[model samples]
Target: MSRFITIKDIARKLDISVSTVSRALRDTYDVNRETREKVLAMANALNYRPNFNATGLVNRSSHNLAVILPFVTNYYFSAVITGIQEVAYQQDYNIILHITNDSPERERAIIKNLAASNLDGLLVAISSDADACAHFQQVIDSGVPIVFFDRVPDAIKTSKVMQDDYNGAFDAVEHLIGRGYQKIAHIGGPQGLGFTRKRKKGFLDALAKHGLPVNEEWIIHSGFSREDGEADALKLLKQKKRPDAIFAANDRKAIGALMALKKSGIKIGAQMGIIGFTNDPASTIVSPTLSTIAEPAFEIGKRSCELLLKHISKRNFIPEEVILPGTLIERESTLR
Candidate 1:
């Protein structure tokens, strides 16, 4: 077996003391640039890497902020994470990730067991199953400050960062209505998510505003996934009178609806107008090029982190809800 290189090896090769080698490796002020460069070059050539877990005790208190979300596969969540990372890099804080996949029990378990003392703060985009706030409320009972983003629990009295989903959905539905689609359907997300309700309201409101009745049969509370969208779309299509258009809660569902329509020999766009929320990349690659509401995911992440930082500082920050506006991006799917 080969012997692993350490500071002692570098010091022995350089004819210097171990303390000097350590200082040089860490780029301390006492170490000269020449010596520091030599040590770094040698370390890199040897493929030496510092283990954060081992040296974290001597380093800062992990400088870590934990972010928990229901899922990470969606582009919206990915964009939000990018924003959180931007602030984390600027503020010199580490960001840890956790996912619960919308399971309420799992969400509770993760929150309950996390060492709040070790974490600087928490930024959460809760799961769809987060109907009761007892688990999150318990976090508040503890000392660690937290800020909820996107899929937050509205029932809880905490700082929340999300988009104006109602307005976004309203615009999409209204746009479809204006395009001469009188009977519009909504393939929504989980019934528990606040955004789902907001989107449903927008769909209904738009219909009512235009003197069209919101048939309860047309509204479906499916999960936020491609499969869910397909199933909901299938059920809607099988009804006595098929809806001319569908305004899905998110891009995944919208894409799913598109696939369902294609399989059933229904032409998208003018034949059956469709729009989705979240300008996910899939929206473009999918057939008919889905029109969508662009969520301010990156901004949501930055705002949530900033709000949590204020709470961490114990500055008597007031709890506030911030709803970032979304934009409408038209494409082939909803084109009339």
Candidate 2:
């Protein structure tokens, strides 16, 4: 069997001590630059790889992070993961991804069973149905740094990074108002999520600010899915006094609403204005092209990972709440 190259071999070849080779490889300040360069050059030439297990035994860290997400099949989540991976790669940390499939029970089981010693930190966008956040608190109490993003738990006191959901929703509604769609309705996400409440507040506040009626029938809360959007849209459309515009929680729901309107032979854009959040890739491909409030998904991921790294390095680091702004992309769906 072939043997693996070790620091001892480099030290013997370079006529230096094993400790010197180790410090040189780690780039310790005590090691002279010239010697460190020589050690690195020789190590690279020999194709030597550092023993992570040995290093972890001494440092009490695995230098690996876990990213917990609802799913990665969508463009938004995939983009966020890309951002996270980029940062982790640059920082010399590895990422282990776990998908919860939007199930709270599964999320709880995953967190409860996670091996804390195997990970340096956690970056999570929680499942929508996760009402009990005690598992997360336990993780925090166990001294594992966790930074939440997008779907954060309001009850948890930890670092979080997300888009400005309230402002984005406000802007979306304001845009509809500017286009003279007075009888506007909203199709929102699950009621339990923090962002959903914030977005709904913004929607209601905008309508109240413009002296528009807040019709209870016009507001529908459901899952963040195309089918939920289609059902909610059909309900609003069948009302005795139907809304002239619909602002969906996300692009998927907006597309569903678009489908419902088309099936009913209602003219989109002119007769029934539509808008969504997240600026999902489907927004561009869908008929009429959904207008939306574009979230900084990639930035959210990058910033969340950066914050988690800070917590990992500094045990007593204070929690930070970062909210990035979103842009409104006016598309054919809202052209009036």
Q: How good is model 1 by TM-score? A: 0.81
Residues 1-336, candidate 1, lDDT per residue (tens digit)?
346566666667778887776777656789899988887787667654443332243232356789999888879998999999999888767898988887888888898889776787889988887788787787777766789998878778889999999999999998898788888999998888888889899888888899998888898997988999999999998999889999999999999999999889999986899999999999999988999999988999999988887876554788889999999998998876
The 0-to-1 C-alpha lDDT of every candidate, in the order given, reads 0.84, 0.91
Model 2, range 206-288, lDDT digits (tens) per residue? Answer: 99999999999999999988999999999998899999999999999999999889889988999899999999999999999
User: CA RMSD for every model?
Assistant: 6.5, 2.5
TM-score of each: 0.81, 0.90
Candidate 2 has what TM-score? Answer: 0.90
**lDDT (Cα, 0-100) at 180 in candidate 2:** 91
Native-referenced Cα lDDT, model 1? 0.84
Best by lDDT: 2
Candidate 1 lDDT trough over 10 residues, lowest sum: 51-60
